[model samples]
Target: MTSGDTTSGEGLLESLEHMGAAERAEHDAEVSAAVAPGREIAVGQGETLLAVDALTVRFGGLTALDDVTFDVRRGEILGLIGPNGAGKTTCFNIMTGVYRPTSGDIRLEGRSLARMKRYRIIQAGVARTFQNIRLFGAMTALENVVVGTDARHRTSIPGALLRLPRHRREEREAVEKAMALLEFVGIAHRAADPATALPYGDQRRLEIARALATEPKLLCLDEPAAGFSAAEKDALSELILKIRDDGYTVALVEHDMRVVLGVTDRIVVLDFGRKIADGLPDEVRRDPAVVAAYLGGTVEDAEDQEP
Candidate 1:
């Protein structure tokens, strides 16, 4: 090989070594940060990880959500479901700070999300997926996930332009973390492929991996199972539970009964901009109001059935 090739190879090895060191440091920082007072708002000791209290949203007389209230307990999956235009997405949007509430408030670990910007909400430990697939189609799966790791970027603009030591360190650390996230979401096999080249299901899993790259305390999924088949939905349910088990509080907005019933610890139902029910999956499933709203039939004395 040419001397130039040899030099490039050495540089690549150095970069990998630097990233390995940074990853170790990052792991330690994560442990310390989790227990650091003030840095962490202590969502663990609290009864709720997310609280949407009487949130109302309107767009020029179009009331999308009205006085919706619910709680997502720590390390649990809370399903938010309703029929078309039932304000499920609206509630999800407001909760993630995509849209401001017309009235009332939202809190994550007792920290009010009132009037917070979307990026600020993410930094405060909330991340969400879109109703539509939003992967960077032209980018590799790993690169797309690396975008989410920008939530932890600390390099100054000048440092990045100049390729300063700090900037190099941060970028390497981000790549390391992004690859780890891809493995966590079961997409490591496609890590080097263009995002658009993956199957639809893999794309969905990639989106979740991207969301996890931000290191969120609460992961909000908006209609994640919108287009999946029966088997895919079943797998998605297992993945959701695994996410919850991995120390995340998941809030799901899905229409698939397989996922809503099989995955969530609690389910909240909304109709006509109003919350009609909030309870365990079985209770919400059997509620006459929920059945009436979803099935469009007159209610009979429905008995509580287990999920």
Candidate 2:
């Protein structure tokens, strides 16, 4: 054979070897993903459902969060609390993918959520309520909750427009589910009322109900007990525990010490954008650092370490 023919044969063999190596790499990746912890843990057996590692957020040199790190354990009520301007809401926003972190990482189960958008985050089994009451003012209470259930909907615009069999079935199911959620939150009687017409305490409950309609594994509530009476707070404490018992991992951000202590299995205290203490309710209550952070006293600062 001529020199050119020999060169062509050798080049074809090299190309085949490269293709085989690439195919093997792809096969290995598929096998790894099949055996990965994320695939198994997606069904919810891990100890930690949500984990934040060295989280920090900065708004033009104003550091809103400084290396905050914590985890929400599965099937427990975890309280995220601190004084005003302590970065609790910022942490909540980050956890819900409302704000991207300036550094560090967030993981759901073993899968990284660092690059997910707000809507994608919801699809990853997270839902949250705002600190300020937010509901569709013009919609009925049941309709507002139905909006939340829409997060789980897969119907296309064409299907919805055509009112196809699948779309009609899903619509009926969504309405039934929304009504069930309203009743669960003790507002079924007000289902036909405008969302804005509910009393302040009931409005808070409605927001929680709407969040629950999303069927999240992790529910983050921002100041849920705000503007509640003593009695309302008591009722809300029970509601939070009930949510936990219903197989949701609750991450609560609230100012009321009584509700926090009563409902939560553990508490993570934030001070000046840093976590000062984290432990069981009684342990955190007696922790000098937490006491100093809230009530203003001197306590030796413990080393800020990751959980």
Candidate 3:
């Protein structure tokens, strides 16, 4: 056959066997864009507080996260949402140093988080709340918050034994700071109450107050609105924004669509451990793939369930 004839024959066979030119070209473009070295997403109005690139985590043969990537801007609330097993919690785990990634990297303020211990991560201006409330039930709310500020305090056996002037001054400052954090979260009234004595909603607030006591630059909350009523959710949303307005960046993993859409400055949607969308709330809400993956096939499904 002539060269043109042979090329034409091969092209025809390839078209019949796989994606057409348009489909293949579009796929190639996506791959190239993903791997290309350029600005990923502009983090809020300033520098990025946290960035996760090609983050992958595995549990035995089950891949919990496959190249998940996103950014949380400084002084903004970034919502991370997905289905039950979509690795939302796992992402929080990796960020807080609860679990190291099998691959990829996590950075805080452009610094590597690899091999950092949980306490070290906290000391590096990262603090987190659990999906399940993890608080000291036996301790008063004030004491619980005081515990959060312990990392920043300079107390030692010698100081405790001798009651040094410096120790007293440090203790007083810590107590004042803890009280301020509790007041910031609007839970100062319950400061003297045992944590378990507070109502469920208040417990959630207490958890946030305690996390804030760490003086974190970036706060990660796992499902903060999980068991809240509508009013409670609204309050939680306002509190989250208030937290951000107070100059702390927040990364929240939540299931309540209303809370997520209402409070987040931006959002990253994951499905089956892979990112399907990342944009402003309205933009992500309208993304076709995000709708299908998160709402199970239709935008209508997502809307109908929106609170």
Candidate 4:
């Protein structure tokens, strides 16, 4: 091998050595599972992880979502962008079982999600963070995250009431995993603080960590960069990319064109509750309908324009 190749290999090894043990282990497991015999990996390359099919929602005389359809591919960041009242959050609400669609359906990996409860949806490997901060005000950040981990625990309420050995064991594991998630989101130092006490940006990160604790197949984030400054938005963008690299499918809904264009693998645009464009960032930016209705001009104009 060339000397330069050896030096590059050494650099990669050093970086891997510094990688978080939990992250490394999780990624290795995903890789191994993908190649294992007779095992259909939960996350597969270029496969559809979520399918929103002809979803229509109506409240009284108004239609919130009119036959909206899209799919989030596994191991990719899909940006869902639109103007205000364009049914973005409504879509999120339906995906997470917060609202039942007036017509149409949502499926995860070919399983129809109709009639599923909110908790059932979470258990089905779909987790989300709200546009507004929804952290538990009285709970410490670690405790809040632990609650998410509990969603995946198998111990029954009866076992927990009796303080059974299995419950005790799972509780310990939950705390450890929660701490690792806090570290992953760059807020391990604030693990002991109340969630409400965190700075606005830190609070947002904490919400993301909690959602990650559920070990979701698809992570839906609604306007996570809504109130962030430019630097905070950049950090958040990196975190989103890290989440995707770690084998989580992300569907991001944001108003900021810069954030959407920078991190998304594909863009899905909605205008007046209808899909106007769905393609790569460049294609969506140049589409005349998207440019006029949402971008407000060319891509250059959209960079400084907020939808």
Of the candidates shown, which would achieve the greatest TM-score relative to the real structure?
A: 4
Candidate 1 vs candidate 4: the lDDT winner is: 4
Return the TM-score for candidate 2, rounded to 2 decimals: 0.81
lDDT of 4: 0.80
lDDT of each: 0.77, 0.76, 0.78, 0.80
Question: 38-134 in candidate 4: lDDT tens per residue?
Answer: 1233347578889999999999999999999999988789999888999999999999999999999999999877679999999998999998899
Residue-wise lDDT of candidate 1 within 1-307, one digit each (tens)?
A: 1111122323433454555565667664653333121223334633687888988899998999988888888767888888899999888788788788889999988999879999999999899999899987977787777788777778767777777898766666656666667777787778778899999999999999888888888889988988898888888888887777666778898877766888888888989989999898877877889988874554443343223
In candidate 3, what residue range of length 10 has the lowest lDDT sum? 1-10
Worst 10 residues of 4 by lDDT: 1-10
**Candidate number of the best lDDT:** 4
What would the TM-score be for candidate 4 when compared with the true structure? 0.85
lDDT computed for candidate 1? 0.77
What overall lDDT, based on C-alpha atoms, would model 2 receive against the true structure? 0.76
Candidate 3 regions exceeding 4 Å error are 1-44, 300-307
Q: RMSD, each candidate, Å? A: 5.7, 17.7, 23.5, 10.5
Please rank every candidate by TM-score, starting with the best: 4, 1, 3, 2
Cα shift from native, residue 32, model 1 (Å) = 14
lDDT accuracy of residue 6 in candidate 1: 23
